[model samples]
Target: MSAVASWPVVLSHGPVTLRPWRLTDRGAWDEIRRRNASWTGPWDSTRPHDSPEPPLTFAGMVRQFNRRARHGGMLPFAVDYRGPGERRGVLAGQLTISGITHGSAGWAQAGYWVDQRWAGRGIIPVALALASDYCFFTLRLHRMEVAIRPENARSLRVVEKLGFRYEGVRQRYMHVDGDWRDHAMFALHVEEVGPGLLARLEDQP
Candidate 1:
């Protein structure tokens, strides 16, 4: 099996940090979701009508992510941002590296969301760079992918800014916002960013 980081691994770049979720984070997480429900609902994935999987609560989701992490199939990160001179960090969002495949494939997908209040500050992009670097250097994954709904201009710009090469689209790729939706796929191979994605982000002109 390919290598994987232990559960609760933390990755950081400046004020943005990606760490595992805690049970105590439910309150803050719930508030963020509730407040941003309208903002994020359109892009959020949904269960199909015929699907057998039950809805997952915050605790249940955390447990599942942790269980998957043990087997090297998932990396669930809760994004935290600490402003300059701040002693403690506040929850900013979440980024999960899932769908990990080992051996020949050696690939994984990253998905993320940020609080509207914290959006456009380069936090999620930094978080993505950190996660991608960990997957490339630490876990030794070959490629990292990000799928975004076609209409999500904000998210689309993120991949563009981070230099993830456009890899076309998947028709009816995933159920989202009450129906199956096409997603624009973008990916970055380890070889494509030898200098590291984080450094590339910092070097943007």
Candidate 2:
């Protein structure tokens, strides 16, 4: 069986710290949600309603994160940028491990989103590489896959840049922007993990 099948609360990288979500993050998280409403609406699942009140309250968000963690179905993390002993940025993303066919499949999936303000700054790549390493090294998972919308060029670039192989399109695979969207599938297997991933940020010139 893959280690990820049984592992819980695995921290991959970063002082780039990937930790459980906190209530203190509500203000910053809500602000980003408000600002990126339109920019992310087309692809994100949690866009708020037009009404004055948010559909999900701060406490609700915490409950949901905790529930998922308890089930071992997902690990939702609040990614923080640590510099000079302060949390500088938020990388909002989740890593999901599902469809456990009792170590037979040995596969899991990953997905992530960075605050738009931090896009193109290489934060996603670093976080992705760190997460990927954890899946292979710590979790002992055999394969990890990422699916991206075709229109999301920035995301596509991240996957390709990381050397995740093109695995073709998954038709109407994900519910995003309130509709079923096709995703271009990309994957990296256990054999593909290596020190090369460490050079991803450095080689991005």
Candidate 3:
């Protein structure tokens, strides 16, 4: 069974929601990525040196995400949440369940990014818990892994907040930003959270 088929198109918790990425999201993406280049570029992944062709167009990126969703390899989502009379759901960031595996593996990898403005608001941990719980319970995935660059303290804090067990450090695990970078890998098994990741996190005070 495909993981995407069993999941909600829009997953919500409190005022936060995670909906699949869309072609119409280009504007928001452009605005955020452009304005936050100094903040996000150091962590964003880049193509290999030998790869031909220019970077993907916004439309192409959306098409690729849609294709991945259909293939069951990923669920690309846009994180939306409400804030002090700021409208019901603002585009806050993105969270995705990528590299989904089924059959005997029954696992997936998670990746995310939040607008800097939303940092320290407890929005990320809540969003992550919601996704993690859905994967463990509804999708019946046995494990979920989150790998973060060692220097990405904010991201590491997120896994910690949710109590994802640290597995190990991966040396040059991925090509991030420009060069290969080491990452701290963390994971959670279905049994690790008896109640659910969201329930285990205990909403911030």
Choose 1 or 2, whichever is better by lDDT: 1
How close is each model in CA RMSD to the real structure? 1.4, 4.5, 2.0
Cα lDDT computed for each candidate against the true fold: 0.92, 0.68, 0.84
Error of 2 at 45 (Å): 2.8
> Can you write out model 3's per-residue Cα lDDT over 1-205, one digit (the tens) per residue?
3344443367888878988877788888889888888887888878878778688898997788878877777778889979967667878888989888877999999988899877777788888898888788777889999999988999999999888999899999988898888989999999888999788777444
TM-score for each prediction? Answer: 0.97, 0.79, 0.92
- Candidate 1: tens digits of C-alpha lDDT, residues 8-38: 7898778998988999999999999999999
Q: Across residues 36-88, which tens digit of lDDT does each residue of candidate 2 receive?
A: 77777777853324547567787797777667666655556666665446656
Candidate 1 versus truth, CA RMSD in Å, comes to: 1.4
Ranking by TM-score: 1, 3, 2
Q: Considering every candidate listed, which one attains the maximal TM-score?
A: 1
Model 1, TM vs. native? 0.97
The count of backbone overlaps in candidate 3 is: 0
User: What's the C-alpha lDDT at position 101 in model 3?
Assistant: 86
The local lDDT score (0 to 100) that residue 205 gets in candidate 1 is 78
**TM-score of model number 2:** 0.79
Q: Specify the highest-lDDT model's number.
A: 1
